[model samples]
Target: MSKNTLINILFLGSILFIMKLTIFPQESLGIGSDSGGINLVPFRTSGYIFLHETFIKFIINILGNIILFLPFGLFLTMRFKKINRLWKCIVFGSIFSISIEIVQLSIPNRWTDVDDVILNTLGTAIGYAIYKIIDKKKMYLQED
Candidate 1:
């Protein structure tokens, strides 16, 4: 297959992975009673960062959210050239995260955390930074 086809597969796969993790985690594990909610304030998840836990668990819970969205920004920018702009990427990332949260509101066993949105945005920003860095290098090499 072509490069664009491969990238589209990656993008679509990522979205499915995200939805499964965020919305269907409990049921995926054979558990029930999945109600969801919304958090208005930011940085609420920071408390988890300090909680005493195994290093792996701590990193997975706190850092996983950020890492989860990193590929989102990259793959999205790669697919949609118009989102190459940093602000556009950020706005799009925020909208995507918020829409997920909103959907969770009506679903069972899901959460709509503002902190997730914030950290997910951070991941997108970092991914965008990488994209810009690589793109700049490409321009520099072309000029040489």
Candidate 2:
């Protein structure tokens, strides 16, 4: 397959993985509830997790959100030249994250948190930085 086709496939798979983790419910996860939860204040959930929750839970809640969306920014930049700027990646990431949080509001036992959007956007920015660094290295090597 061509490079572009491969990237597209990978991106689609990543998106599905994200949806499964965020939207799909699994009873085994102990997340049973009749309705979802919402946290509008920034960092409230994260702060609570950090202060009261276990270290592992904190990592899963905070870092996982960011890592979960890193591929999104990378794939977007790779697939679309129009999203070449870091700010564009951040904006797109925020929109995507906000959409997911909004959807989570309807799913039982799921949570809608502003922190997730912040972390996810940070992840997008990190991904964009990684891409730019790699691209710069490639250009430098090619000129050598």
Candidate 3:
């Protein structure tokens, strides 16, 4: 298959994986049933998790949110050159993350938190940065 085609397949798969990870029930993931609440205040959930929760929980709740969206940003940047700007990546990431949070509001055991949105956006930014570095390196190599 062609490179762009392969990237498209990977991007679709990544999106599905993200849906399964975020939208599905948590029992299979071993987290048990979440209380199902909304946290609007930025850093509130993250701070609590950092200070009171187990290290694993902190990682899962904090870092996990960011890591979850990294591939999304990378794929988005790779697939659509129009999203070349960092601000575009941030906007797209925030919208996607916010959409997920909105979906979680209806799910039985999910917690909708602003912190997730923040971290996910950060992850997207990081992913875009990585893409730029990789693209630059490729350009440099071609010029050599």
Candidate 4:
């Protein structure tokens, strides 16, 4: 990524981080009434599916979590190209999630849950994975 791209990503990431901190404050903190509890089932089975409820909720939840920190991953990746490795991604994601959890714990309306950290890390990994796939594809195309 170029300097301009790095700057853009940082600027956008900051904006997104702030927006996330405010807009879905409750959900982000894993405290909202609608923030549903964590299900032990790895994947929802057919029996668990409700007629009115779409499986898309699972997808939406996963995607929303992944998307929430995408800008963070994108910006970090762009800014520190040298450390653009999986371990670094994991560390950054972990730290970010930890920070959020800590903040949530201190906030009045927020409820910090270890589960949220796990979910957030999973989300960060997903975002980083997406970024890697796209970045690699772009590089391959350019090489070709």
**Could you say which candidate leads in lDDT?**
3
Model 3, total clashes: 0
Clash pairs detected, candidate 2: none
Q: Candidate 3 residues 1-144, lDDT tens each?
A: 999998898778768878888888768565427577899999998889889989898888777878888988899899999998999999999998899999998887688889989998999898899999999999999999
- Against the correct fold, how does model 4 do in TM-score? 0.63
Please write out the lDDT profile of model 4 over residues 1-144, one tens digit for every residue: 987876676747654674466335555444353432333343342224333457775555555556676666666666667757877877887787777666655455554555445666676666677778888999999998
Clashing pairs in 3: none
Worst 10 residues of 4 by lDDT: 38-47
Worst 10 residues of 2 by lDDT: 26-35
TM-score of each: 0.80, 0.91, 0.94, 0.63
Pitting candidate 2 against candidate 3, the one with the higher lDDT is 3
Candidate 2 local lDDT, 30-139, one digit each (tens): 44344668889999989998999898889887778888888887887887889989889999889988998898887777888899899989988887888888889999
Q: In model 4, what is the error at residue 33, expressed in angstroms?
A: 7.1
**Superposed model 2: Cα runs more than 4 Å off:** 26-35
- lDDT string, candidate 1, 1-144, tens digits: 999999899878777777776666555443235455567777555565556556775566667888888888888888888886889999988898888888777777667789888888888777788878888899999999
Query: Candidate order by lDDT, highest to lowest?
Result: 3, 2, 1, 4
Model 1 TM-score, all chains together: 0.80
Which of the predicted structures, 1 or 3, would earn the higher TM-score when compared with the native? 3
Candidate 1 local Cα displacement, residue 18, angstroms: 1.4
